[model samples]
Target: MKQSTDLPGLIPVFPLPGALLLPRSRLPLHIFEPRYLAMLEDCLKTPHRLIGMVQPNAVPGRDESGLHKIGCAGRVTQFSETEDGRYMITLSGISRFRVQSEVDGFTAYRRCEVSWDGFDQDRAPISDTDCAFDRKVFMRLLDRYFASQDLSADWQTLEDAEDELLINSLSMLLDFSPEDKQALLEAPSLGTRRETLVTLIEYAMRGGEGDVMQ
Candidate 1:
């Protein structure tokens, strides 16, 4: 299902610097800013209220600067309103998009024309190079990683996941640098992405943080 470049149901987007949303993965977000809270409200009003999540290098006057060109569109699948009126929303990524141009809108949320190049509306096929043996090794290391970090995870459910989920979750757990995440986002195929993620994890585990993200 290739999304039309001219898809008519474009929604408001919120750009989050340094976060990457992969397909079939869920990103939890806290929406507290007034502008973003309004965006969440508007999204709730629509059936498919989607927003683009991107990272900015710095915030500018506040220290977090401008945004990166690439981002992923996520739909607000689950949301709740807190006592203080803050919003807790779960963003489920739909697809990747390259920013084409920003649109001037009255709302605080930014709007942009996007091009779906790396991600069409479908998952790229897994390649032969992504062998089962390597995947097993990655899982073993992943278990060690979880244990080392004292993270609670469902191992049974994890064991049932396909290669793609395993790789995506691994990527998130490694907390790869933004640049490295971008590289994974731009990977041409699933096998290649998996391999790159594995390499990144191995490198990070070897005390190579500086080189990992760059």
Candidate 2:
């Protein structure tokens, strides 16, 4: 697949807590709200069907209260419209971006001016050989974490996945809190992310009482 690094200055954003989209990963979304439905329509008409997946600040209030500074840009790779005017879409992760400013837009959905310079590496693939990640340790921690959460998965698939895919997929699928997900999304490198994931798993196993996962 071609990497999507040519991001626009302003892009529509979906602020969902505890949801994550990482470079080279895929995020499946169901657009039921009217504003998000409209966002989906507008994205389909564009040459680059892109959307920014961000996390809303933990503060309580309206949905648009606040958002984290960092997020991942994803391309709408699969889409379907339901008779009820809802949309089901799958986004293929492109790159990570930092919000520079929030743009005033007429659309009910929000838009942000973003910068992708710091995450330029997200556009390129990193070989597992370049990192000193202990997959066995990660998997062992994951096993205990899953048991505590009462979740199960195909172990074989996870064992065979590439390092990047394995780490990112776990980051997205795990039932971590919003803050934990954001930390994974903001980790500086794949190796760092792997370390973060292991730490998060251990924390969860200890019943959420430990040092910060970062």
Candidate 3:
């Protein structure tokens, strides 16, 4: 599929180092920083509360620091405003973005121009064998992974997940290193992404770093 170039109606972004947003996934964020608070205000006045999610190459600290070349743009699907004037928003991933430029960051938040490229939104297929393996092997390992991390999950809903939901949700939930998340974002196809998630799950279950299977 042909990738999308920067369109006229692009949104500003606050780059959060080390986090990645993959297509079809949902990211829940608590907006507390001042610049991001203003960014949310700007988005509220617009038709779509859209923003790009990017990472910084170095650890994020202080003003005007490290940021990476790529990120994803997401639309705010839901928002709840706190009495203290913060926003708790859930963003639904729409497209992948390449960081074009970053604005000055003297203010509380930073902004950037981004372009979407190389992400396909149409439903991609997963083989029955792959899907079954994804369910059985991946879930077993995922349960082990959660236990190792001392976290608990609602397995009932997770067990009923559709293939796409299963893949995307698991990808988002894993405490993968930044590089692993970036690789998942750059995966060629949905099946490939699913396979990557399964590989990560199994590796984490075995207490290993991400391996070549992804």
What is the TM-score of candidate 1? 0.81
Best by lDDT: 2
Candidate 2 or 3, higher lDDT? Answer: 2
Per-residue C-alpha lDDT of model 1 across residues 100-126, encoded as one tens digit per residue: 777787887777777767566333343
TM-score for all models, in order of appearance: 0.81, 0.90, 0.78
* Candidate 2 structure quality by residue, lDDT tens digits, 1-214: 2333456878999998888999889999999998998898898899878899998875556654788999998999998988987888899998889998888869999999998887767887653222688888778878888888899889999999988889889989987788889999999988888878887887777787533654
lDDT of candidates 1 onward, in order: 0.70, 0.85, 0.70
Position 66, candidate 1: lDDT? 59
Candidate 2 has an lDDT of 0.85
In candidate 1 the C-alpha lDDT for residue 82 amounts to 91
Candidate 3 lDDT, 122-200, residue by residue in tens: 2123321233454676678778878888999989999998776777777777688777776676666668877777777
Q: Is candidate 1 or candidate 3 better by TM-score?
A: 1
Ranking by lDDT: 2, 1, 3
lDDT of 2 at 179: 83
Error of 1 at 128 (Å): 12
Model 3: worst 10 consecutive residues (lDDT sum): 122-131
> Which regions in candidate 1 have their CA more than 4 angstroms from the true location?
5-11, 58-65, 121-133, 147-152, 211-213
